[model samples]
Target: MGAARSRILLDNDTGIDDALALAYLAACEHVEIVAVTSSPGNVDAEAVAANNRALLALCGQPAVPVLIGARQPLRVALVTTPETHGPQGVGYATLPAPPGPGEESLDAIDFWIEAARAEPGELIALFTAPLTNFALALRREPRLPWLLGKVVIMGGAFYHQGNTTPTAEWNTHVDPHAAAEVFAAYSAAAEAGLDTEKLPILCSLDTTERFEMRPELLTDLAAAAHCTAPEIVSEADPSGTRSGASNPLVRYLSDALRFYFEFHRDYDQGYIAHVHDFFAAGIAAGTMEHRTRAATVAVETESPLLIGTTVADFRGLWGKAANAHVVSWNDPDAGFAELVDRLGALARQLDPMG
Candidate 1:
């Protein structure tokens, strides 16, 4: 076998987009998923853990460990997006039940602590959920920032229209206290003269929204996967329609994304999906092209009306060092094309006879 290009520790709440992100990562041959820790957002932590394991198994990467993490937000009662991500977070896709909790089960915080300490500066961390689990990990080991090689986060609105609230994004709004703690930890590290190069690359909604998933991409993906029949997701279809795709992977993705498409249509965004996490996943794999701007980032945790709002000081107006490299822009056309090619390669591999 070939050497791994990047080692990643994925922390996500496996909503529809999160499932797509995990599938994209699992499909990539050069990427090594060290572990996955469930965080509450799209669903409860236990359900998120199940989604991660089920998707990984579907993608033929069942060996990757799936750990359980914080079930609720740090300072608030948990809120899940069943309306947006369906009841169990995978939309209409019904995956094989994950094996019962046993040796496969592990604590997220403990894994983060042990893995980082064991191989300092080797693991690249990616957070596509609320920061609850990572913040708890930081509380246990304050030096996690220095121990990890790099970090990539997918949260916050960053001046974009909010998907959850008037001023907040879904992930941050789910657990603003944990989000606050994460940025504060980085700010403290910068003040202490630590190597700030390890500051996370944040994929806020500003640019992520540009990577929309229209129904045509699914048709293209099906063609790439060499499916015997066309896979189509239509907005006019009766609600809760399921895919009858010939390819297993295509069928799974089609079912999941159909729910996402309907959700977006209901919100008046047409039948397109803002696959925010998938873009972040591409950045983590070093495959998708993108640009960034250094900024001092912070999330609001106090104001009742502004809780979970993220503000970025782009010009050092905060008189503090930059805490993150916020993504400024991304090539959505290239992004969509890359996604189709990569995911199609995996689907074709999984069911070659098609």
Candidate 2:
């Protein structure tokens, strides 16, 4: 294959893992992250933007466009669980205080409008947080349908059990309205000849959970944080209890994520906390491949606890038709290794004292 670095716009909520994914993307030689839009999920939107700035700084990348978006879910209140991620997002990384002034002041949708319009049909949008900003962007720019590229989203539990609720995943659960809209757009985009019709590429929780943070990866991460800030949370808690540690950023996000992670693990002992968004970045950056099968992936709009659940079935819907190719299974070990290798490569590129 030839070298094809994608022009990308990443939408995230600045969760700890999301921060990790950003660092990887900043250092990837094959991807050009054009812009970053912040949303509400694991952390608040403004904090999300600040966190993005921090990751960019870590990678020695100068001021990239960090646009703020969707402080709360569309038509719903913001729900952030600190017991999983910690108090402040970076496992409670006490940020040095945000920059004096924020960059380009466009809202999430408008920023998307500008970015996509500037590079019509050539941008790879990576969504790691809730779909709130994306849905709003679609509503704001009807022509977004025409100015699009391949979309790689990191949310939903297609075949695997849910991580946030009985049948819902966090990114989708936070905003089912947006999730529904995004899925509809995905289907419509496929139908409109923008991207592939059977193009439901999912980097589900299954693939993310398989990534065991090998000692080398963790050490690199921890060492990089020495001058920046200490990590409050040590490692994944097997018993599902929030950690009682004291790092600036790590504690906040880890505590919040632990609450969510514990609930999922308690319900299904087979579950491991997935770093969720890493796969989206990898797929968007062209470091991975996903095999798709024709399927009907739907998000539940009215379930009580299972509201944002994504269900994938082998049998296609008769009327709706199997117009999507959702991922049912992934090679866990291989995928995990690739993720680690990429992260390691990024660390070497960004770590200053190395």
Candidate 3:
């Protein structure tokens, strides 16, 4: 009949950008989201699950299963960011309650193992959160590295100053031990003769921070929303007192980004926000223009001063073979344009009433 849609299993922590990434994927026509697994990072696991369910419902994909994952990092105490993502992890955006509680039959780590076993070389695992679930799965099933089609992760701060610590990004910083375990496991698997093509691809802050969502992009997106879903704009404000944005997807994103924008302005001295996880999802979908360099990456697990630091050995300092494809840079103009176009297209596809 038609070309098969790419199968993906998304593991996220349901932060604001993660929620945006989920909505972006739900609107994509060429990818089929098999399931979503949540973990604790920006928010707790239970709240993350709830956010995923609520966001999916708002996007009209209420049927997509949301599975709760680890309540905390593998070995470290729980660290959350209510200050960054607001109390609910979605800023001021208020979504309807999910239709029901998420699937409770299996743990998220188990689900990852079973899905990989069932699909073998056909499942694309996208990790946009801490790696506790992945580390646990790999511990339980060592063959997991060779069984998946590909692994794309969004973490680390290579070549750029860290967001959480002087040398660590938030995701990796939240669970450095788990992150170390995952990178080392995949490297060991490759050395043991598993195909090299299945190695993990990392989208780090070095590239993601280059592409910021400026006010003009948001304005254009709102305009596109107005053209696509006029009714949503009307409903948002019946009296027309507010800036009309008809697309629920755009409205949701715009609302959630208000807080993020403020954070960037204060922290980074910029008025725009970086959509970090969205770039990772784009890399997984092969829709972003990027430049990569193969490197031997190791996460610092023991040093307190450098905990969660992604030590990318581009100079062969460690005498280890390269195990990860690191995205050194991305074309900011092309990336921003593609992201805006994709978002607008999704808004139109999901809400064609305007």
Candidate 4:
């Protein structure tokens, strides 16, 4: 893991998976979380920012700034999936409110634009939310692609079934217009001959869905953390049940993921959770293996039926240059194992008595 050196500027909706991603990043030693920005997706921007602050504090990174961005998606009524991620977007887990003054007043767009410019090519932008904030920032700073070191996005289902609509991913569907704007801006940068290495790594649902989390991972993590009692999360557990693990981190994760498992099972997808954002965060931190193909990616915004559907042309079928390196391969089992090793170690470090 290159967490000792990765400088990450994260933007997320702070849902269940987003919380897990943020917690993982915080656990890594010396990982410079430049800042975290809230965006609207699984929940509203306010709740998202709150979640970020709370998660950071729980992970012992309380000083990390949590900025509030756009409260609504660009050009659409905000649609939140409370049923999917619970009321506050963190499943049934109850996190304490942040303790101190945070980045509530600071504009997330301006903060990112300034950060990217002040430290040109030094910050990695990990966007795991709707593209509304990034799109709005692009309107102010059109050269975002040139300023940031690299980008990793967790949205869009290129070749897989959509979790929101029949043809649309949840993040993209929340704001199709913004997703289109982001891809178009990246395409422009690619046309201007930006380094292919710096091209955005799109961690679309096609690969992320493969990162399905199962109950055994909780057991492994608990064992690694040397918990006193066995930790179990099963499909047979009653709905709305919470974790009573001795370790705080283990308890938080177990309770959070229990809701996700139920969500998937309710949709007939079994008791596993598709932790999409965790893979993106891991890729940005250089802690996970992944493969991507250069593609000219675009979003369908105007069509009523296919809106928010991300279309990728890999064979130069479209005359445009490649804007994103769409992730094509990843190992879910390996990723889960790494999560247990890294996060479980961090948990033990945080609570030695456990």
In candidate 3, position 249 carries an lDDT of 75
Summarize candidate 3's per-residue lDDT along 86-136 as a digit string, tens digits: 788876566788766667445888888998999899998999999988998
Runs of candidate 3 exceeding 4 Å displacement = 1-4, 227-244
User: For model 1, how does the per-residue alpha-carbon lDDT over 1-354 read when each residue is reduced to its tens digit?
Assistant: 123498999999999999999999998889999999998888888888888888888899888889887778888999898899999998999888767662235788999999999999999999999999999999999999999998999999877988899999999999999999999999998888768679999999999999889998999999999999888778788999888888888998899999999999999999989999999998888887888999999989889999999999999987999888999989999888888988999999999998
| Superposed Cα RMSD, model 2 | 4.8
Whichever of 3 and 4 has more lDDT, that candidate is 4
Where's the lowest-lDDT run of ten residues in candidate 1? 97-106
| Top TM-score model | 4
Error of 4 at 333 (Å): 1.5
lDDT of 4 by residue, 223-246 (tens): 888899989888888898888888
lDDT of 2 by residue, 189-294 (tens): 6556754532546666656555433323343333443424433333354553443322222333344444434544554643335566766777778776666666
Question: lDDT of each structure?
Answer: 0.90, 0.66, 0.81, 0.90
**Residue 71 of candidate 3: its Cα lDDT?**
82
Candidate 3 local lDDT, residue 76? 87
Better of 2 and 3 by lDDT: 3
Model 3 residue 317 lDDT score: 86
> Considering TM-score, where higher is better, how would the candidates rank from best to worst?
4, 1, 3, 2
Report the C-alpha displacement of residue 114, candidate 4, in angstroms.
0.6
